[model samples]
Target: MRQQLRRQAGAHSDHLQDVLAVQERELKRRFEAAHEDRLRAERHKFQAELAVVMGELKGVRDAITARADLDRAAHHAQEMWVACQGLKQAIRTGQLGAASWQQQLKPLRDEVAAIRQVAGEANRFVESVLTSLPEEVLERGVYTEDALRERFCKVERLCKRVNMIDDEGGSLFKYALSYLQSLLVVDAFERLPGKEQRDESISPKLNTYEIIARARYCVDKDDLLQAVRYMSLLQGEPRLVASDWVRDTRLMLEARQAADALLAHAAATGLQAL
Candidate 1:
């Protein structure tokens, strides 16, 4: 009878052990599933945030990509500025992540690094274009392209003031001829290329009004060299008035060219060639 009791107790013990083992396995499985679910949620969030950040980064990329033409750089400055702002926001968002969160984002390490590198390159390019100059490339410093344009306008206005008080003094007969010439300038005296549009009513040579208009048109067309050429044709006070402006415009052009080379290099090298 005692032997029978011992066997029964042993059998019951084994059964209990088996049940406990099965329960432990079930508990482990549940815990694992919970952990995986949590991880998946976190991954989804990271992916969403990463997508937004990448979109912002791509905006900057697109603008730079569209900047293949050097003259178009000035045109796209505002676009670049806006994209850079978006990138700045994205970087700040990334930096706001906690240390523990950063570890959780380990899978995104490469992507985050890539964003940082591109952002760094973009910032350098934008600063170089908007405020700084490649003195090594251009051998000179310059104002921002926008500032150069503003300066030119102010200088043009100052030069035009010379016309408002024009005093071409000469003999009475010469003055009479000049008055007749003035009358001939009922409209601006334009010596445009292609063919002569001259008539009795139009002056054969460019008047001050025509010179200013032509130079302005050249500038509008991003033809700084031609603008300078037009301005150089001025005589007397207008020439003196425009001399400094012309010099600065030339400098701006050189600096702009240097910036263009830098931009092209950056583009050619996948925008990583800062």
Candidate 2:
């Protein structure tokens, strides 16, 4: 009986040990699964944060590109405006030159009229561009100093070409006078108090003889040395004092005295002879 009891107790102890082993294995498996789930959650969170960061970077890049495009457009519009203004000024100067020559030569009027027509077309084109440009561009003062200077240089070159052509066509004096007159007109017109008055009245009347004479008088008074220089260029190596005499110091003196005498005679008798 005693031996049987001892055997039963040992068997019970062995069964309890086996049950504890099984419980330990199940606990280890559950802990491993929880650790894996936590690691997976952390990885998913990292990927989501990276995606958000990339999206923000893309937005910033797009904004930068948009700003750059706006700047370029504004710059282009300002350049166009400056070019148009310069072209208008050149056309006005050309018209003045033509008018001055017309008083002395009829054919010059036709040339000037053609230039005026072309200028009108250019003006219309510029006006269209101005109208089409965004108001923001003008408000921002998009024209750079370099752009303005370049346009001015281009217009000046055109004026120079016109002057050269006029000189070649046998009207150097008239063209020079026209150039001086145009400068004065532009200055005065720009200095006017009101934009409307300048644009409507002063700007359009820049091609008149009175205007030329006024400009010449102003220039002469301002710089006598420059006036003398210009006059010397115009006279260009005096060749003859009169129909009868070749040019010399003595002949020049005699010619001056004769001119004074003729002026006096004309004043006295209101008569002149060629």
Candidate 3:
């Protein structure tokens, strides 16, 4: 009986040891899984922090770059102004003359053009700067609004002089007149605050007047081609129709069109040449 009791106790001890071993294995697996999940969470947190830092760094870099660009642009503007002053002084001292000044004009014009390109606003800022300059400073060979006007007058006088000398100054006169007219147009457009203010400014009316003047000049020169071009420019503006010059020019153009159509029909029908 004692042996039977010892055997039963040994069996129970072995079964209890087996059960404890299975529980220990399961607890170790659960601990390892929890540790792995904690490590993954820590990695994700670090990656998120890194992404935020990179974004901030990029923003700071962009701001620094933009500031640098602005500084460079400002420096270029100052240099252009200095160059302009030097050129004006040279012209004043008789270093440049009408015979050779046009060649020298290219460099200064390029400098102004460079400013427009770099500033990204085109001619707006440059024209505004020119407008702010004194008339006397502008008159001394600078291409300001007043200066260009003066130049145009001089060119007109030169044309008359050449005509008196029995020389053909038609091309030169037309070129100078066209340049001044274009400058006036650009100046007027720049004067407006926005695209919507185009009609509000006196620019359109001024443009019509300029076109009419060009047409009259063309008529005086007997330049039918240029007159037609000037007339076409006024055709877009219906408001100028009340002007006698506009009315006359339109009538002339209509008469020319009718004549052209008749000539075309005559040629198509093999009629004799006029």
Global fold similarity of model 3 (TM-score): 0.33
| Pairs in clash, predicted candidate 2 | none
Write model 2 residue lDDT over 131-208, tens digit each, in one string.
443332223212222232233334333332233232235477765765665555554533323222212222323333
What are the Cα lDDT values of the candidates? Answer: 0.56, 0.39, 0.45
TM-score quality measure for candidate 2: 0.28
Return the top candidate by lDDT.
1
Per-residue lDDT tens digits for candidate 3, residues 82-189, read 544443443333324445433322223343344345434554644455344333332332322223233334433332223212122246665566456555553443
Candidate achieving higher TM-score, 1 or 2: 1
Task: Report the number of the highest-TM-score candidate.
Answer: 1
Candidate 2 regions exceeding 4 Å error are: 1-32, 95-274
Candidate 2 global CA lDDT score: 0.39
Per-candidate TM equals 0.34, 0.28, 0.33
- Ten-residue stretch with the least lDDT total in model 3: 159-168
- Per-candidate alpha-carbon RMSD to the true structure: 20.7, 24.5, 20.7
